[model samples]
Target: MSGEWLAEVVQTLQGLGLNYAFVLNPGERGAFIRGMGVTLQLCLLTVPCSLLAGVVLAALLTSGRPWLERPARALVEVTRNTPTLVQLYCAFLVVNMLITQRFQLHGQTNPLTPFVWVVVVVSLHKGVFHAEALRAGIEAVPRTTLEAARSLGFSRRQLLLQVELPLALRFALPSLVNNLVDLVKMTAVASAIAVGDVTYESIMIWSQRDNVLELLLLILLWFGLLTWGVSVLGRRLEAHLRMPGYGQ
Candidate 1:
């Protein structure tokens, strides 16, 4: 849409007591747009990474070896037990501090941006929940299914990959979706680190304009759209991957 037409719509909304401060203000508009870009980037990058991490972590947890299982279990316990904000602080303030100090002697710069920190931290946090959910699903698989796989001479790894994981995924889909939805919300914590996400942008604009109500409404609408999109995508996946005569 053209700027003028958008401005007209903004004017109309203003009459209804919703002042979208960024519509006519170019500077605030630019900052808010940048924030939106970061938010979208977080959603796109973190969700897939978390899923991959979850799969790997779940495999580690069920690998039947103390060496792998112990570390993975510790990771899950630490991540799941802590607040996301604290995790972000530890990742950015603490870990990044050490990285910077370590690299300073070599004249090397820190490799990651605030954006990457948020992505890694959030992915690990949500990944643990996904791992747990999948673990439960794996345990819930019927005895007959395990027997059939064993009867076919399936090795432990082969059985997990070929037979168990597929069914476990179906069983865990709902919980995974819920985790992902929360993952999207967790991306908001990026704002705390000055990543310029939508929430951060909204704060900037509203603080300058003293229009908290207006900005909050828009923020809610924006996040509502994002979370709704995740939900719809999850529902479609559940339907497409649904197993007949199971969980009916």
Candidate 2:
């Protein structure tokens, strides 16, 4: 469609209070802000948690114990093989139900809030993929580097912290950013559990206004802006972290 038509649609929607932030209703505007906040909060929470879990899982997968390593590998494979939506649903409905019922905590406050559960599940699901990325990066690090660190009296922790992880992280940075971008988009699934995220709020607004196109456009704009900004920032940070000896 043409820019003029798009602008006209946006204008008409704004005039009819179909836009995300309806000026006529303070409550609707507040809800929109809250939803945006929730989306941001989910992304921020999930990214770090997923990255950390991925690193730990990668370490476990690479370790010497056959049982632990095999199981870790299997878990990663299973998680990667499963569809994310099914995983989210099963994790939310079935696993969550089992946990609540098994603990006899039905009457008690749920330990996992809707927001927390969204972050936790998304992080863990993405963590599987990230684990593979990190594991590959770790393996790509030269064995000579580890031996060099050992010969220099570096402890295991020091070797990992100073030598392995840094180099591995550099190699994994682009993939990690890609994973984070996916994680941000996946936050839309939070709407399924009534998390009051952007998508949920947009749906509610559109239901009342009967302006599906307007609401959807706003959603697209918001997501596009957010993801684009994130990509730009990631690229800049990646360049800043580039190793002098490493080729682009």
What lDDT score is found at residue 90 in candidate 2? 86
lDDT of 2 by residue, 178-203 (tens): 88788888888999989999889978
The candidate maximizing lDDT is 1
Q: So what's the TM-score on candidate 2?
A: 0.87
Candidate 1 clashing pairs?
none
Error of 1 at 22 (Å): 2.3
Q: How many clashes in candidate 1?
A: 0
* lDDT of candidate model 1 versus the reference: 0.90
Give every collision pair in model 2.
Answer: none
lDDT of 1 by residue, 1-248 (tens): 68888889988988998877477877888888788788888999999999989988988898889999999999999999999999999889999999999998899998888989999999999999999999888888898999999999999999899987898899999999999989988899998998889999888888778889887777778778899999999999999999998768
